[model samples]
Structure formats: structure tokens, C-alpha cells
Target: MNAALPFRDLSPDAPRVRVTLDGAPLDLPDGANLAAALLAAGVGSFRATPVSGAPRGPFCMMGACFDCLIEVDGVTRQACMMQVGAGLTLSRPMGKVAE
Candidate 1:
């Protein structure tokens, strides 16, 4: 193994953990919000339209807009308002309906 590879030491400053999103494993930063983390992970959409089945993501990161809504730990929540935690399980909503 190449010793120079990054993330070799998952220390506090270099926090490393895995999270599951829509049944996919994702590695995210230690203290970032789900919205931010998803964005950084190259996720352009976080939700689907109720009527048309289109895609959506964070719009007003301050919790005013309902665009960034998602399900965390089996509960509906705003992705922008929830911080990313280790072993978190997230599922994007297909629409406005609660699951």
C-alpha cells in the first residue's frame, strides 16, 4: 500500500466515517450538514417532485425553504438543518409525502 495516500489516519482532525444515502454508502466530512455533504459528494438533486417526479435539492439553506427536506433515521427532517453524523442513514423523499 502506498503510505502517501490521503486519509490513512482517520484521526479527529481528519475525521472519517461512512453514511448511507438511498442505500448507497457515502464518505462525508465530520461536521457538515446533510445538504452540504451531499452537494460536496456531487449530488445535484436531493428530492423528487410530487406531481412531475422531477429532482430537487437545497434552495434556502437557512431552513426557510422546504426544498432540502429528507428522511433521517426514519424521520422526516430538513437536510440543511441536520448535521452529518457517523453511520447516519438518509433517504431522499420521492415527493412531499411523509414516509
Candidate 2:
């Protein structure tokens, strides 16, 4: 594990919640960082740069960077600053997605 990664130890029986991404259901532990959870779930990209159309994910786990932008509950938000919640719906920003 990388020392700089925002890794948190979870108990074997950590409670989980169900959230939807791009209409697909995902199970994530409660209170888990949304961006980290998505990445751990194999989501490689979050959004693309508006100009160059480059795919981007989380650059900083904190709220300092806007790379991890996504739609949550009908609004664009920074995934890294949000916690996984039950019934939350998230979608990638509409635009060019990395191939």
C-alpha cells in the first residue's frame, strides 16, 4: 500500500450501502470516500477535461482538486469529498469518456 494513499482500515464486517453509478448498482461501505470506493470498484475514470478531453480521476483525495467531478443527486460534485451513502445515484459527467 502506498503511504500517500488515503487508505483506511475497515473491519471485516463493515456496514455497506448500495449506490448507483451510471445506472449500475454498487455496494460500498458506509462512510467510505466516494472516489476511493469507486476506484476500488474498478472505475478508472471520473470525468474528462473540458478542453483537451482528457480522462481524469482523483488527483487529490481532499477537496483541493476538481479532477474527481461527477454527478450526484442531479448535481455535479467532487467525489473525493463525499461519503458513500445508501441510495445515492452517481453518473459520470456527460462528455468524452476514456476508451
Candidate 3:
């Protein structure tokens, strides 16, 4: 679970961009990191471990960590490394994750 933070409270006029995640629509800051957007939206687990089924969420907001890996337009990408784009589709990467 994500520890809730004051998102809009941080900036009353922060610009927002719309995006779809796991088939759900969300609005987030246009320049905010995608991972942060997910977290702010209370999406805790980005994916589950293929082996132990442990929940994996973003650890580092930088590109150094793969824990935030997500499916972007059918490609695996680190959510923390990208900004929210309007109308972008994101989902949990499924099937045959390397062991």
C-alpha cells in the first residue's frame, strides 16, 4: 500500500494530464513521474513477482531501479523514468517474466 501524500495540496494550480492505467483513466501532473502518478493515485503494486507472487512497487524514483517496471504500449519500461503523457495506456506486464 502507498503512504498517501498531499498531491494537489502541494500545488493548487498544478497542471494535470490524463492517462489510462490498467484500463482505468487517471489525471496527473503533466510533468510528474509516471511512477509517482501511479502512487499518488493509490496504485500500490505495479506488478507481482512471477515466482513468490510478492508485490513490487517503485523503490527509487530514478531509472536505477527496475522495481517500477510497467507495460507501456506493450513494452516494458521503468515508470519512474517517464513522464505522464496524455492518452497513454499503461498496464501490468503479464506472462513469462524472466525468472
lDDT of 1 by residue, 1-99 (tens): 123322232333556579998998978778776676677666767779777778878888899998897888888889999888899998887855444
Please give the lDDT score at residue 53 for candidate 2: 79
Task: List residue ranges in candidate 2 displaced over 4 A.
Answer: 1-12, 96-99
How far residue 13's Cα lies from its native spot in candidate 3, in Å, is 2.8
Q: How does each model score on TM-score?
A: 0.77, 0.79, 0.79
Clashing pairs in 1: none
lDDT of 2 by residue, 1-99 (tens): 134444444543778889998898878879888988777666768877766777888988899988899999989999999998999999887565456
Q: Is candidate 1 or candidate 2 better by lDDT?
A: 2
RMSD of each: 7.3, 4.8, 3.2
Query: Better model by lDDT, 1 or 3?
Result: 3
Better of 1 and 3 by TM-score: 3
Name the 10 consecutive residues with the lowest summed lDDT in model 2.
1-10
Ranking by lDDT: 2, 3, 1
Q: How close to the true structure is residue 74 of candidate 2, measured as C-alpha lDDT?
A: 89
Among these predicted structures, which one has the highest lDDT?
A: 2
lDDT of each: 0.75, 0.81, 0.78
Q: What is the model-wide C-alpha lDDT for candidate 3?
A: 0.78
